[model samples]
Target: MSSAPTPAPGTSTYRERLVPGPAGVAAVVLFAVMCGLVVLVSSTVAAAITSLTVLVVGLVLVAVTSPVVEVRGRELHAGRAHIPVDLLGETEVLDADGVRTALGPGYDPRSFACLRTWTKGAVTARVLDPADPTPSWLVSTRRPAALRAAIEAARGA
Candidate 1:
């Protein structure tokens, strides 16, 4: 894991940048190569165009799919949703089975999720307010325990 960022005074910050996994990378490459081959079989001009098109598509997919999780200034930012720490209850690390449950049967449509198929572990934050549509927040993380600790620190738990 990389070193976490330090926020200014009065804030405990934890930021993580999750990029495409090995499999994702492979998929992108395979797509480009396969498209190139298929086009090359037809015409060189079309193959060149296909190569460029595939490259752009691959980059866009990875860029849009990447998730950045951060906790700063009493707020938790996971993907696009931003929630105040005060509204959060207990936060914990989720293992493989726990992740499956949280993302599967236990999933909430309103919950904020930046899930990635490549990610194996996650961190869950319970919503304290029943009125809120979201029951909880499930965020994919490479370092679930560290993220939990960061949340605890933010909550002064």
Candidate 2:
């Protein structure tokens, strides 16, 4: 198996934004509208204000709660979890079909996956550490090629 390459100290190689989809935003808005409708039976201005407040807060929450994926220094960070680049073996950039398969039929129970429904692209990296139970990492990303390139460059460093 190929081993991970060392990276320069304190350098960030990659960062992938996990934005919520249009459907998700729409759902939030729908919920806010429903809330406003319920309050509409009372006051118009108050209902409008409530709906706007809920919409803004809901959107902010969605953005804030979205998991971040980044390759910083020698580690690959996904959400709240991270692993040393030296423990990663091979990195592969995955398209939509590959992502579906990787998350479906080809999935391993022990592998770590940071999936987002909004993203169709992903990156898979083999975990080389014998001591760790996780076999690999399959993380959803908007920029699959860039993520793969970052991991490869960090590993090669």
Candidate 3:
């Protein structure tokens, strides 16, 4: 993936929506088809309506539930949580192995992690606020390097 374009000072430097992949959509569609086929053995019209409704509802839920990651002004937003850029320590981009470890045995109980199995990379940042109980944040992303750069730039600004 390409790096996110740098925005003007105090503007959003990066933003991304973690939407469902094609495979996930396909799986939902396939399940709808299977349900339709089973119901078709009884009533064709009912089967068609049921499958259509299921497909529409399923896709809508998936889309609406997708998380957003953004770096705007002096803060970083991951899903519904936001933190000040200045309060973050060195941000590191992690590969698949590092992500696995961070999410596994190396994980800190006090850390906040927004993870998705589909996303391959992640960025980890230590929290600098001594009073806060949370030690760090682990954010899953498709573009870890871009996120790290955005956070670093925002911190500098």
Candidate 4:
């Protein structure tokens, strides 16, 4: 098998970094607390099994969320999702009201499936393919404007 190419220093190419924010930290802490509680409420054997399972799953989530976004060459990877730079079209930075309006009905903030509610705002990405059911993705970000600009620049390249 061919070895993977190394990334150049100070370049956007092949870079993967967490989209640093309070949400990730809070999630880790919350998971830890929940796991602890589970251990406290269970029998010795049950506690050991449950705690180990939770620890593994929680660590995986921490790893995934720790890197909010990763730019690997022309691809952008974000929280269990990935998109090609070329496939990205228009971008919009939206506030709470704007996000609600843009997302339309069926929006539920509690679900992790959607962007975390702790996010002050979001960056909405437009997909190039008309046939794609997911027309846009709402990303929670501390700096929506900056994220939008970065994605736009990547797409332009």
Whole-model lDDT per candidate = 0.80, 0.87, 0.88, 0.62
In model 3, how large is the Cα lDDT of residue 116? 82
How does residue 148 of candidate 3 score in lDDT? Answer: 94
TM-scores, each model vs. reference: 0.80, 0.90, 0.88, 0.55
What alpha-carbon RMSD in Å does predicted model 1 have with respect to the real structure?
4.5
Best by lDDT: 3
- For residues 1-157, write the lDDT of model 4, one tens digit per residue: 4444443333464333444356665666577657766777657677667666776777677666554655555555667777776777777788988777766776544322236666667767666767666665667665677776666555553
The pairs that clash in candidate 2 are 5-155
Task: For candidate 4, give the lDDT of residue 76.
Answer: 59
Q: Put down candidate 3 lDDT per residue, 1-157, tens digits, no spaces.
A: 4444455656888898887788889988988888888899889998999899889988998888988989998799999999998899999999999998888877788898888878899999999999989999999999999999889877773
Tens-place lDDT digits, model 1, residues 63-137: 876778888777778877778777998887888788888877757788878777677899888899888988888
Say what the RMSD of model 4 is: 8.1
Worst window of 10 by summed lDDT in candidate 2: 1-10
Q: In candidate 3, residue 72 scores what lDDT?
A: 93
Candidate No. with top TM-score: 2
Show pairs that collide, candidate 3: none
CA error at residue 75 for candidate 3, angstroms:
0.9
Query: Considering TM-score, where higher is better, how would the candidates rank from best to worst?
Result: 2, 3, 1, 4
TM-score of 3: 0.88
